[model samples]
Target: MSSSGIWQPANDFRRVVFWRHGRTLWNAEQRFQGQADIELDDVGRAQADKAAALLAAVGPARLVSSDLRRAKATAQALADLTGLDISTDPRLRETYAGSWQGLTFEQIADDYPTDLLRWERDDISVRAGGGETRIEVAERMRDGVLEALSGVESGETLIVATHGGAARVAIARLMGLPYEYWGTLSGLSNCNWSVLQETGNARNPGAEGSWKLTEHNAGTLPEPQTEPVED
Candidate 1:
């Protein structure tokens, strides 16, 4: 009902639920998985199912997801549960790790210690060899989130699935956290979901608005136990 022809703002306004994709083989390996196209592991599939069930409980009107296989797979599970088709956006993809794509953290530390240390210190512009800078990742993620918000009218609920680092950037920006504190934020678990609320006057979509983080890294289902069970 707004100018964009999207649904009109109800008194309740809109909410966004951001979900991190389920676990992958690389995740189990504790590898830097950026931009790598690994599929979900068996446990990851169960995680996706749990996430979908969780989103269904909240009842979002639309589902949006990163175009990457891991994210899409996770989003699709939720979409199927909620009977909503997913709208994929490549902009939501994870930060490109470049040369570090398939390497483990320990390996990166050993091979690129200085870069790793700088990154840990929150250098927004630091780049791993052939990798993306934090600034670049933030900018694209911010633009993608803002664009998604603009497309929907006030009061519409949206669900988005993306990667850990990208999720961190998006959440930090939405909550107005300091750029340096990006590391302070908790890492998102596979299939975990976070809820954010947006408020603004429907008359002016671009007008000053308030965004709040209602939930942070909450999962619909329990994480698969990595520890071995005792007999």
Candidate 2:
């Protein structure tokens, strides 16, 4: 605790809430949507509405989303509540999965067994369906997020409405995790979100600091924890 009882680091760091869009018919069908621009289903709309209300309490200062339909729709739910304009970025879109984009999990597994296994193992070099490598996705996701953060001032929050894969890689990239460790983070469920706070260490002024994962795959608001900090 600081002398003034303030979380002093709050002034130095920025909070980012990375939210996954709601479910789509493709998602329910276990098909890969990738950057296919699928819309949310009925249940997805309800989930977005429910999640938006809870997230609004966080008082986000900036809202950004992928240019894809599902992600745009998800961002709109929160925009309607907060009256914040949604800034769309194609770089924030899901990885372009090429031949695997519209295929079901079973289909991909049956057809591209080797590639699928590599992907599942988080091989940064393997290009799924001969598409973007995990490193490529992470690079773009990192660029998009850093661009969004440029507009956000210290002590304010930025909400990124993006896809599950994009969100995972982005979070991992922001936290400075190795590409091999990216798979350790679980995929987010529909309409769930994760939170990251900047570490505010001594680094280049314009460079983003290492971020700490504060929350992951959360459907409900984060509660204060009084547990002892582990080494």
Candidate 3:
């Protein structure tokens, strides 16, 4: 652990940052994107440019992104600064909200109230729009992240550009949180990111330790964790 009471990756360890894509028209309009393959709007491009500068300073070694245009675009910004090749993975795409794609929250509430409620409740079996459940998404996300991390060397940082919902679920799974408690973690805002430090070699199958969430929904660089003090 570092002096800030937060665990920092040692020379033998690695770090992973899950970055959410910037705002799209649907995102700005409060519509459910859910693997719709939307591109970043003008404002989103600006957001990515700013964020890429900061993230680039940290010296990320590799970039992996969802195959969707929005995520690919966001990763491209950081790649431009870092000069790292981007690897796109379809498994990192947002939850496929089958019939619910392209609808607003209000529309889903009115049309599929029960399913919406179940989704909000984090029901593992509840598949919004007859799409994959949270568990399914989590599994695929875990696999994709692990596959990407396999190439990451110690003391290196791997950045993942993905959608908000996909990032949250993957974070929860990577942290070993149960599916029902996934909602406890706040959602990521557009262009914000979460950081996870490896406690063990999660890249190796059946590794000893889990990935610990060091930061969440952050626009700035990570700060030290505040620990309790004794008088």
On lDDT, the leading prediction is: 3
Give the TM-score comparing model 3 with the true structure, all chains together: 0.88
lDDT (0-100) at residue 14 of candidate 1?
74
Order the candidate numbers by lDDT, best to worst: 3, 2, 1
- Cα misplacement distance, residue 127 of candidate 3 (Å): 0.6
- At residue 133, candidate 1 shows an lDDT of 79
Model 3: weakest 10-residue lDDT segment is: 222-231
For model 1, which pairs clash? 13-155
Number of clashing pairs per prediction, in order: 1, 0, 0
Those runs of model 3 whose alpha carbons end farther than 4 Å from true positions after fitting are 1-11, 200-209, 220-231
- Expressed as tens digits, the lDDT of each residue in 181-223 for candidate 3 is 7888877777878998877555553342478888888774342
lDDT of each: 0.73, 0.79, 0.80
Regions more than 4 Å wrong, model 2: 1-12, 202-209, 221-231
lDDT of 1 by residue, 1-231 (tens): 433222333567777777889888888887888887889989989989876875676667777888989999998898777788888888898888778878888888899998888876768878855688776776787677777776666567778888877877676776666787777766677887677677554243333335666677775455543311000
lDDT of 2 at 90: 94
Decide which is better by lDDT, 2 or 3: 3
Query: What C-alpha lDDT does candidate 3 achieve relative to the native structure?
Result: 0.80
lDDT accuracy of residue 98 in candidate 2: 86
Ranking by TM-score: 3, 2, 1
